[model samples]
Target: MLELEGIETGYGETRVVHGLDLTVREGTVHALLGRNGVGKSTTLKSVIGQLPVTVGTVRLAGQQISGRLPHDIARLGVAYVPETRDIFGALTVRENLELAGRLAGPGADWTVDRIVAFFPNLAERLNNGGHELSGGEQQMLAVGRALMASPRILMLDEPTEGLAPIIIQQIFGKLKELKASGLTILLVEQNLNFALGLADDISLMGRGQIVWRGDAAALKADDQAHARWLGV
Candidate 1:
């Protein structure tokens, strides 16, 4: 379980997220949907300690974590997979995964072998550098690396961005499996169809805060909300 209350954060003094409040219940996938620049990524960054929350509290399982360091937040079982897929380009696929596990300092349920198996495509790419992987493979590596930390809640930003349709389907399937395994996920995605397929609950963000909240069927039926808030 994770909660953000009245969060205000941004780059320098230029605020992007304004009074944003969101919550992810245990063992559920909650999708944060929005157009570009609605602060979906910023909210994730703020929760992970990449950006400081100026006004409001971020709580994970009822423990306040807004002011903590990124590594510290990670140690508390919060893992983040940014849209950039920030893997170490110089390191081999195995090295990239092993490094995260090593930094996590034991007790991680995910191991290098486990990650490789989870992303079967990575099994043969073990000795290849991160730079050598395709976009899909890189995305898988990014998710796999995050899993190495044995996170309680995983936050992903734009996981389906700029990928082939087939690759997106693969990602969707993997996420489905993750959800079935009871891993809590907070997803910031622009792909409405993808989000609807995986999320149990969906929240729409406009400007910088939530404008609508509902399940997939409810979202589909809300033409007014879509037209007004989503410009559909």
Candidate 2:
């Protein structure tokens, strides 16, 4: 239940996203697919208030959120997992989750223990410093921190980036389970196979605009569409 209409954004004078539009339905995963420098992340930043919309509007369940502060937007049920693992290097894994929980306030869907349960490895390393964890573990910690906020919609940017294949599978599996449990997700991904495999709907973007949008499964049957729009 998020919508972006005619969104135009950029860093300073160099515009990166132009006239972007998309809708994310509740209880489903909507993917934003594009190559590098195509404004996929910029679009997300615009929606989440990291980058203000130069034009157009962003709405959640129909109310406008375009101009709200980043923290306010987050408080309104949008959780972001950035491409960079934004974990505190010196903080304990548990402490990170706790801080996230406190920042999001109470009444979150997932508790600290619930997050620990979902990530058992993190549970064992609860007191360990963030720097001590492996890359996969760090990724898990990032997701766990976001989950602690108990968001209504989760926007993940390259959740599988740099992870081993097995770890990626584990992460995707968990994401699928979350979708099954009614979590609406907006995913920004470059791994075509990975995005198509899990996305309910996929939109291919180029140069800051959506070039194609369709059911994820349909892309496989239409090689021409894939070749022309996705460059795959």
Candidate 3:
């Protein structure tokens, strides 16, 4: 559902992502794994139109979206949840979901009730401000907000970073459920076990390029690749 060919993008003149090529099939979870500075996040930003692609083509569902504006790309059924978990600190939980749903229009599949059902903790804290929630709660809120867009492809950067193990498990479970529901996902993750457990396909990046690509089981068995690039 998503493909990036010869992707070369970076901040200003320094190219961080060098001739990267990737493909995420429909209704599957594809994980991008790499150490710090391998351009995993930059690749995602380039695809989502946050970072400029100096040389490449980004296609979503066979439509070119390389140089489009971020909002315009989002309108084409692409939802990006950055590592920062960008939520409105001043907005109450209910208000945040309401605003996202309103922006998504009436045909969105994700509703406030459904989001709450997926995240029962959010249901009880509907009136709480975003700032009032814990780190895990905030991450849940971020994912919930992205789902509110009713996206065909969900891109997440470091969703499990700094969360408790229990919360991470919960997040993984929700992602599994989303995958089961035929949601295509592109995930940039540092956690090896987490990525290996949930991803159908895995790609390892090094020096802004994809060094290895394989199924999850193949990656699990390739200890040399894991140690060389991922330091695992």
List model 1 lDDT by residue over 1-232, tens digit each. 9999999999997999999988899999999988778888989999999999999999999999999999999999899999999999999999999888865756668999888778899999999999999999999999999999889999999999999999999999999999999999999888889999999988999988999999999999998887877774
**Model 2: per-residue Cα lDDT at residue 155:** 94
Better of 1 and 2 by lDDT: 1
Please, what are the lDDT tens digits per residue for candidate 2 over residues 1-232? Answer: 9999999999999888888889999889999987777888888888889998989999998989999999999888898999997999899998899988965765667888999888887889999999999999999999989888888899999999999999998888888888899999999987787888889988888898998889877878888777776674
Residue pairs whose backbone atoms clash in candidate 1: none
When summed lDDT is taken over every stretch of 10 residues in candidate 3, the lowest stretch is 98-107
What RMSD, rounded to one decimal, does every model reach? 1.0, 1.1, 1.1
lDDT for each candidate structure: 0.92, 0.88, 0.91
lDDT of 2 at 66: 97
Candidate 3 lDDT, tens digit per residue, 153-214?
A: 99999999999999999999999999999999999998888888889999999999999999
| TM-score for each model | 0.97, 0.97, 0.97
RMSD (CA, angstroms), candidate 2: 1.1
Ranking by lDDT: 1, 3, 2
Better of 2 and 3 by TM-score: 3
